[model samples]
Target: MAAKDTKNIKLAKQIYDALSTEFPDSSCSLETDCPQNLAIRGILSAQCTDKRVNITARQLFDRFPDMESIASQEPEVIAEIIKPCGLTASKTKSVMAFAKKMTDEWGGVIPNDVDALMEVPGIGKKIANLIVGEVYGTPAVVVDTHCKRVMKRTGITDSEDPAKVEKDIMKAFPEAQWISIGHLSVDLGRKYCTARAPKCGECPLSSFCKRRI
Candidate 1:
């Protein structure tokens, strides 16, 4: 391996260890009882808080119950129910599209393949990776805003782009750590390495964080 890769690997281990110790019970914040429900929640989570998404999704599912029911509803109705999560028009189309796919194509089974999941309109790489990783236990990294901020600030990757950061993380950490690293990065970002006025001193990774030094 190259010298840069060696350094990143070592640093990544330290970060993983520290974050593991700091947030021992980190998990995906999206609340759902079923895989399809989780997939729908992922679609609704764009530019919205997970807590709001959860609430709106509950309202949505309480009425629809199944993709077949959702697929059958008018886009306007779905839009009305999901308006609280914002982006009503586009999110409505995407949610109905996903439901139709679930009922018409996938036969109620959410796919484990990321690319396949991304075929639905609003389901981008982030949501696709989340669906596969969370739903199927696949080793895919979810580089959300929190993950992006924390990874860059930690000197794990010199890039701010989520895609590049994801690749850097993939190369630095083992496959088993991929899913949890995203959660851990999120914990670090939310608790200490925030986008503005970060709490570096109190951060668990302060000892090794380049930004802290």
Candidate 2:
């Protein structure tokens, strides 16, 4: 892949500036204080909305409350609690398995390393990066649906693959901004650049966004 063009770089900077003004306090929307909980929440957030994950996690956590509680419980029970988030069976197994591993092996703390996070069940590159970034305060590009859509629409990257998109975005933005850029892109996706009907006219990046229609 060739280096990013000047126009794209300028657009990225504009986006960064605009989003910084739009959401100065932007952070991962998941409501959790512990790194282990954040990692589990990020995994459960896959193919599910953050709002739903927050709700479901709150209820589920109220019942289980800790890694030991979750690790000891049956997957069926976990699935029952998380059914509202969809994909209950698999998500439940994943959550339980992840908790068990963390409790048994890591003493209930999430590892700061990306490769270690990927070792957890149901954690892929995207979720792993999210956990590392949000929990560990490490700089990582989290290319979720919103980030991928906005990046593609703005011509920042040509690929739909999350890994490829992440790499492209990491190359475009400075390392210090990677963790916050994911949340900013998500905010832009929700508020202005929606997947169905993006509000191009009112978007902050309208001056440079290639998807203006």
Candidate 3:
């Protein structure tokens, strides 16, 4: 590799180690045990907070009970159940479609491949990576909004698009650190690197962060 690229990778590792220490045991905020449940929760999380998604997920599961029950429900019913998470109509379609696909096509098996997850409606690269990393224990860079903002401010990437940010992170850090980086960045993003008027002075990464304005 070029000398400049090599230096960046070394720097990235330093940042990773620091953040990992600061936010040990970091993980996806969405609470779900099963892949199918996680897939549904991810769909509900778009433009929504993890807290709200988790609350709505409990209500949804209570009403529907299982994947087969969810697949059999009318779109209207699903929408009504998840209305608190917002974008009810679209989220409902995505959840139902995903459930049906899992039931009819994969025999209730969640695909470990990103492309396969993306085939489900509302399952974008972010959710796909989350599922693969969490459910399948695979290396994945889940560039959600918090991840995108924190990585850019930390001088990890110049791109704002999630796909590009994911690429930059993958290149800068080792595969084993990919999943942990996402969670650590998110924890930092929420506590110190907030979108507006970030608490940079108190941030652990402030010393090295570009602090892009």
Per model, state how many residue pairs clash. 0, 0, 0
Error of 1 at 176 (Å): 0.1
For model 2, the stretches where C-alpha displacement exceeds 4 angstroms are 1-6
TM-score of each: 0.98, 0.95, 0.96
Best by lDDT: 1
What residue pairs clash in candidate 3, if any at all? none
Candidate 1: global Cα-lDDT? 0.92
Best by TM-score: 1
Candidate achieving higher TM-score, 2 or 3? 3
Which structure is stronger by TM-score: 1 or 3?
Answer: 1
Tell me which residue pairs clash in candidate 1.
Answer: none
Q: In order, what is each prediction's RMSD in angstroms?
A: 0.8, 1.6, 1.4
Q: Which residue window of length 10 is worst by lDDT in model 1?
A: 185-194
Candidate 1 stretches with Cα past 4 Å from truth are none
**Candidate 3 global lDDT:** 0.88
Q: For model 1, state the Cα shift of residue 116 in Å.
A: 0.9
Off by over 4 Å in 3: none
